[model samples]
Every structure is written in structure tokens, then in C-alpha cells.
Target: MRRAIDWAFRDRRTGAITVAQWPNLPLWLFAGTSLADWILNPPGTVAWALRLIAGASLAWWAIDELLRGVNPWRRFLGAAALAGQALVLATAGP
Candidate 1:
């Protein structure tokens, strides 16, 4: 049974399947909780934190795409927007 479970999870293409997909439940829970809190209180600190995180993630993804040599202009615009959002979050006071 254990071997079967492991085989099922093992990535056939790269042979490097991650168990993090299941173990990051707590992270997803925290994200959901923060989203709910932001929905209930729009201009709260938690909302700003979430915004900052999202902006950073966006910028990171944009940079990654650009590094792959895909759509320079699109990535630049996306990174710029994300940086602006991060700046807004930074300037927002608690």
C-alpha cells in the first residue's frame, strides 16, 4: 500500500514530485483567513499585507517569465504594476 501511494505521487516526467502540495494546508488556510478578514475590513493591515504579498508574487512571476524570454513588454508592464502596488502597500499606514 505504501509503495502504491508513493508510486502514485511520484512524477513520471521529472521523477521529483513534491509532497508540499498536501503539506501546505496550513498556508492555504491562512490565505483564506486573510482573504476573509480583508473582505470584512477592506482597509485593514491584514489586507495591506495580502496586497503586498500578491504584488510581490506578481512581480516575481513576471520576472521569471521575462527570464524565459517570453513577452518582454508584457512582463515589464506587469512588473511595473506589481511594483506600484507594493509601493502603495508600503505607504499605507496601519
Candidate 2:
């Protein structure tokens, strides 16, 4: 778990621990926070924003995956995740 967090939160471009170089940190952080919010809190603005950002980012990633994905399953999963996120974003929160 520690290794996973370090790998995910690390600065990919610089191979260092810095705020400026984390490309996917926001996405990961939003996902984590969203999950926690789902468990502990009611839907609200934070949930909306988190889903909106995560959905939009994943949608864009799906587009890229469709174009140049490494494998068939990954592309399929990306598209599916984007769809699921979009659905949740649209229907969730107030």
C-alpha cells in the first residue's frame, strides 16, 4: 500500500516528491475523496466537482486510449470507466 501510494503520488516527470510534477495526483486524490464522501457524507458540491473533474478527465483519457491504447481490454475498460463516471456525475449530488 505504501509503495502503491508512493508510485501513484510520485512526480512522474521529475522522479521526485513535489507538488508541481504530479500529473495524476488530482485525479487520484479526487477519486479517493469521492469514495470517502460516498461512504461518510451526503452528496454535495464537493462530490459534484470531484465527479465532474474525474469524469471529464477519464473521458479525455478514453479518447486517447481509443486512439493509441496499449491493449484491447484497457481501452474497453477506459471507455467503461468513463461512461460510469459520467453517469454518476450526471445523476449524483444536488
Q: Which clashing pairs does model 1 show?
A: none
Write the residue-wise lDDT of candidate 2 on 1-94 in tens digits: 9676555445444555432323354446556656766786756777667656656666666566545444444455557766776787688766
TM-score, each model? 0.35, 0.44
Weakest ten-residue segment in model 2 by summed lDDT: 17-26
CA lDDT, candidate 2, residue 27: 48
lDDT string for model 1 (6-31, tens) is: 46455444566433234233335446
Q: For model 2, what is the error of residue 49's alpha carbon versus the real structure, in angstroms, after optimal superposition?
A: 1.6
Q: What is the C-alpha lDDT of each candidate?
A: 0.53, 0.58
**Candidate 1 residue spans exceeding 4 A from truth:** 1-41, 70-94
> Model 2 Cα displacement at 81 (Å)?
2.3
